[model samples]
Target chain A: MNIYLRLVYRNIRANLDRASLFFELIFPLFFIFVQGFGLNGIVPPFDVGNGRVISYSLFLAAGAVTLTVINGGTNAGTQLWFDRKNGMFEQLLMGPFTRAQYILSIIFATLIIGVAGSLLVFGFAFPVLGASFAPTWEGALLIAGALFLGTMFFGAFAIALSVVLKSSETFQIVSTFAFFIFLFTSSVFFPASAAPSAIQAASLANPLTYTTDIFRAGLFNAVTPTVSLELGVLAIEAVAMFVIAVFAFRRIRV
Target chain B: MLMAPDQVVRVDELSRHFGDKIAVDRVSFDIARSEVFGFLGPNGAGKTTTIKMLTTLLPSTSGRATVLGHDLKTEGRKIRAQIGVVQQQDSFDQGLNVETSMDLYGLIWNVPKAERRRRIDELIGHFEMQEFRKMPTVDLSAGQRRRLQVAREFIHDMDLLFLDEPTVGLDPIVRRSVLDYLKERVRQGLTIFFTTHILEEAEYLCNRIAVINQGRIVQIDTPENLKRRFGSAKAVEFKLLQGTSSEMASALSSSASVSRFGRDEGSGAYRVTTTRPESVIPEIYRLADRLNLTVSSIYISETTLEDAFINLVTEDEKAVANGGRAS
Candidate 1:
């Protein structure tokens, strides 16, 4: 096998434990079932920004799929922290692969997990949530684009953060704080359109909002020009984050 | 720059500084094929830093080096592909069992599957890891972890292998086994760059040893040459069948040949360090006779590499304190 492929396989194999399983699959399922069901009766159906309306479970299922992407990216980036602690970071760099290949393998592995997790959530929702499933070619492309761009952006951002932070304690604290802040400020749990003006403005400023918007729109076959516009903005953010990650990684001492 | 055909590593005045602190200063050396070159030093003595720079894990602040005929700066990837390094720090996947970890390391080196399986079995047996082969690496004892770490490095082929304190934490028997294993590899034409604080280990395995102090190379020579040059003072000791009087102590202490003298607390033997043990031994006999003390036994002990190493490093420290370079 190629060096990059070997590294990717190593990353995936090393991370396939119970803790990662909880974050990648079980955690998202909790949000989709418990939270989605608890609020189903009190909260009315959601418009989903298209003419058709959907149940609360169906609406939150899309957001839950996105939760998998976030978790996958976080796991991918924290892998670096673990490798550094265990001395594998220097060991791998001194192996056959270049620095670029090592970083790209990590990002690529997260992308694979993110897309697979999202598809699994989508499959679960189709039979369980009683949601309709039909889409144009463009709708499917928009969902694919959202998963790819969003995973890349978060993977790179977390990697950059891990490289800049000195200790694992600080990394965990900052990452958790950032996760909750991004979760509340974005359209992951609720519609930014229905939120107050302050939250809506903050949501608009978050790149994750654009990702969530594209994903939700595509899930309901509600493709619009705005979804494409959101995809464009996400692509730019992903590229920028990737550049920062590479720059920070190059400056690392070991 | 092209190295000689026999040279696997060639370092030229390489240095690394962290801000104002120099971690590795202007170090230069060469390792020929099939030679086990030992780097012996005390703690925090730039041994690991030098290994890191030579292994392509860290860049030097100045100067140059070539590993396997590839430049350290521009050709790090090429150099890395042909070399193996077992670092001082422990590195392995905690989630994987010992056998799996070895297999994964083989995979990283691009060793074929069938060969990886064959080597895994061989290493597990050779390193005596069968008792814990199925145990997770995180749960293994420090010695077991170290054995696995060293054993896994043999799974792949490399022209030059760098081992930074590889035998640390091993029991004496296991340490000897590991050293013997390395000797077998050396016989098969593998060049080794070994670092350790164990003087006996260096004396046993190294064809030539380099002693580093304060980020500088203090001395580099064969172990025998090192002992001959710096450890020339032999220890002369004589045990008295009868207790000694004050006169006998005074006579031995005032002798011209004996420079340092002390009594062994357990054996009641008078020990003296002298440049000329032959003269000192005869003088000790005369003093014993005049003092009416019976001399039971007398012998001259040989100097060791540990004595030479301490002598060199102590002299270097004293020279630095006096603002002079060590000779």
Candidate 2:
């Protein structure tokens, strides 16, 4: 097997546990099943722009996929901290592996989990919420791009954070705070246009907002000009975060 | 230039510094094929640092080294591919069981599936880890974890192996088993670069031992030769038939062969430190006859490698204290 694939396999096998299952599959289900339906009568249908209005369930389902990807990215970064703390960072480097291969393995593993978890959410959302699954070729390609770029961006950001922080306790605290901030200020729960002006501005500046927007457009088969702009911004952010992650990784002692 | 073909590792003037403080200072040594070269030192004595540099885990600050004919600076990956290292720190996935961990390590090295199973079985049996093979690593004891860490290295084939305190946190029986296993590997042409704080283990397993103090190699020789050279004084102890003996004390103090004399209160014996045990034993017998006291038991104890190691390190410390550098 190739070195990257070997490492990715190891990562997947090691990380597949009850906590991972709850985060990737169950947590998203709760939001789509409980929160999405619980607010159906009170919140009204979401206006996804381009004159398309969808039920609150469909909107939160799209956000669920992006949320799963975000969690996957966070797990990838958290894994790096654990590896360093447990001495496997030096152990792997002592083996027939380079720093590049090790970091890339994390990215690939996160990508796999992100795509798989998103599919599971979509599978469960359509059945439980009485929604339909139909997407044009363009919409499908857009969804693929959104998942890939979203996984790459968050994965790199988390990896960079993990390397910069010194202790695991600090990493957990900072990551939890960052995760809550990014989730709320973005379009994962509510549309930016429906929020206050300050939060609207914050959502516009947040990359998670772009990821959720692009994913929502693909799910509804509403690939508009705005989706193109969101995809472009996400691609740029992914590349930028990747470069920063590489720089941070170079500073690691072993 | 690379070392001769028989020399698996050649380190010359290799040093490592952390900002302003030096960890390994211009240490030079060569390990021949199938040789068990021991690095003996106290805590913070640079043994692990030297191992880290030689194994290509850490870069050196100055000088040069080569392992298995590959240059340390340029061909580190090549060297890493052909060598195995068991560091002082524990390295394993806590989620995986012992068998799975060993199997994963073999898979990382690209070993075949069937062969990985065979090596895992062999290592588990040799290291006496059969009972915990299915247990998660987080539940293992420290000694079991250390044993697992050392055993996992053998899953992949390598000509040279570096072990840093591999037997630490192990019971005497298990520690001896590990030493015997290492000896078997060395007999089969595996060269080992070993580091340890246990002088007895080094004396038992090392073909040649290097005593390091303050990041410097103070002495390097075979264990027997080390004892013979630095441990010249013999401890001659004799138990008197009579309990209290002021006459025997005076006789022992006035004798020229006895350099240092004291009574061992626990054993009810008189202990003497002397270079010439032959003359000292006879002088005790004659003194007993003149004092009208019967000689019960007497014996000469040989100096051990631990004694020699302390002597060398103590002298090195004194020398460094006087001149700010070890001789």
DockQ-based CAPRI category assigned to the predicted complex of candidate 1: medium
Model 2: number of clashes? 0
lDDT of 2 by residue, B1-327 (tens): 668879999989999999888889999999999999999988999999998898888899999999999999999989999899998998888668999999988998999999999999999999999999999988999999999999999999999999999989999999999999999999999999999988899999999998998899998899999998888589998888887689889888878887899998888888998978889888888888988888888888988998999898898898888895633
Clashing pairs in 1: none
**Predicted structure 1, TM vs. truth:** 0.93
Stretches > 4 Å off in candidate 2: B239-258, B262-270, B276-296, B324-327
**TM-score of each candidate's B chain against the true B chain:** 0.89, 0.91
State the number of backbone clashes in model 1: 0
Residue B216 lDDT in candidate 2: 91
lDDT score of model 1? 0.87
The sequence of per-residue lDDT tens digits that candidate 2 reaches over residues A1-254 is 99999999887776456576666688888898889888877888856866678988788878977888888888788778878876788888888888899899999998998888888888877787887757688888888999999989989989999998889889888987998888999999898888899999989878889989998888887677889989999999999999999999989985
Fnat for each predicted structure, in order: 0.66, 0.67
